[model samples]
Target: MGKDLILQAGRRTITMETAAVAALEARVDDSFHRACELMLGCSGRVIVSGMGKSGHIGRKIAATLASTGTPSFFVHPGEASHGDLGMITRHDVVIAISNSGSSAEVLTLLPLLKRLGIPLISMTGKTDSPLAQSADVNLDIAVETEACPLNLAPTSSTTVTLVMGDALAVALLEARGFTAEDFAFSHPGGALGRQLLLKVADVMHAGEELPQVSPETPLSKALLEMTSKGFGMTTIVDSNGQLLGVFTDGDLRRVIDQKLELDTATMEQVMSRRPKTVSAHTLAAEALRIMEDNKITALVVEDPEHHPIGLLHMHDVLRAGVI
Candidate 1:
């Protein structure tokens, strides 16, 4: 084939698959609602099963459901007949996927699932097939044609099935009020989890590492502290160690423009009083937002009594992967 023919084939496949996905929006009707209801009301895990290409889609669906707080897992239909059938219980809901709605391996488990009184939901292209007929709710995933030129591949069918699964998972997630924090719990190692779960105290420089100066401290000394800590700023505390103000590299520029004597000027003379601060319990991601909004790079982490306990730097947040 010519290069142009190959490019045309790829574009045609995507166009066909896109149309199939668009058709799904109209098919999210009563059956889709019933399917969501069954899965949402399930007291135990949602068991997803399929055969062949359908099985690949099923695994992805199961993962999306599980991560979205549905509590689901995929079980190969072929394995379920060989003692794995014990995995399904009366409390669970089953999702069976098959484009033809007559996958023999998948159909083999329906009798057992029915005997156990488990709710059955089916995603199939053939509404009249045995699998769809057996399901309590059949989600129609019929596409006009396969993306494959010969109409023999699972292209458009599989895309529609996967998108239908995503629709179901998202609908159930909203029904259950699943939040980002809830999602983070399921994906603790991911970037979203770190952003949601990590707090200022978890990544801030505290105790001896914190750069602090008293209001009476000379400007030269404060600059030394800022340089030593490498935070580009330092907190100015009162006699009782309460945060009184903050001085930063920005202040240094101002002082230079005014030609102020750094050796003689005290922190109280040039420090920004009542500077923006964050509590140690504030989320690192929230701190990043505050930093971006104010166009600043660091924030003073304070205690309940307004005492400076630590310093949160943008670099710290970035290093912790909370961004």
Candidate 2:
């Protein structure tokens, strides 16, 4: 009834759930390895099915598996009886989740799945349950007790189930040698996609939008180019269009402090030479790292011939969500 009592109860729940999850570490033995091996070798997608709270966790597990290189989807046990059983194939692997491991909807499909010759993987708190006995590989997700005070709510059980699901998915992912670039393909709308898939050329200002001036150009003229291009910096290039140096607002401050006349001083005399340059094909994420490490706000994108082709500013990466 009191605030301290409620807080204490909450802490107990967390401790119970944490212990339940930790117990699963020992269960990740031969059975877990066999399950991962089966899922990895499956030619068809993994069909995850469950009932009640287990179903919710199953759906999330399926999603995690799908996004992390394993082809998978959730199939409600109830619907599997109502024509959705047609979704299963001989090549597919089925992951059935149930704390009791004897849900009627799931049990009804055992015969059909067996007849179809599909491998069945069961996750249950009771390894002695019917589902476990029928499965090709049984993943024991047994927990000591529920986090609920009355020992009725599916608190710790569901948490353990979810963690076991993650273990299986991650094992398969690592076994497949799935890379970040491969993950980006599955999530083109997320930040990871932008980080791994977007190239410097994709976000950099190119052609007429590039702020550049010849090395012999006056500092005042370079300032005009920087302002016109709105990049706050201008790249200095040789007559043949090869990069020579860069002049930024920082350089302008130095010139002013030393009493150099902007109109009369050439960029070659005041510019920072050997400016940081990146390839047009380089990933935007790598470019962002380079800028952050050097404390610069912009970089020049160059072609194979060392010609300045584009300019990438930190703001560009920010707008593209690469940051």
Put down candidate 1 lDDT per residue, 178-270, tens digits, no spaces.
998899899889898998889898999899989999988999999999999899999999889899999999999999999999999999999
Off by over 4 Å in 2: none
Worst 10 residues of 2 by lDDT: 212-221
Model 1 scores a TM of 0.93
The local distance difference test score of model 2 is 0.93
- How do all models score by TM-score? 0.93, 0.94
The TM-score obtained by model 2 is 0.94
Error of 1 at 76 (Å): 0.4
> lDDT (CA) for every model shown?
0.93, 0.93
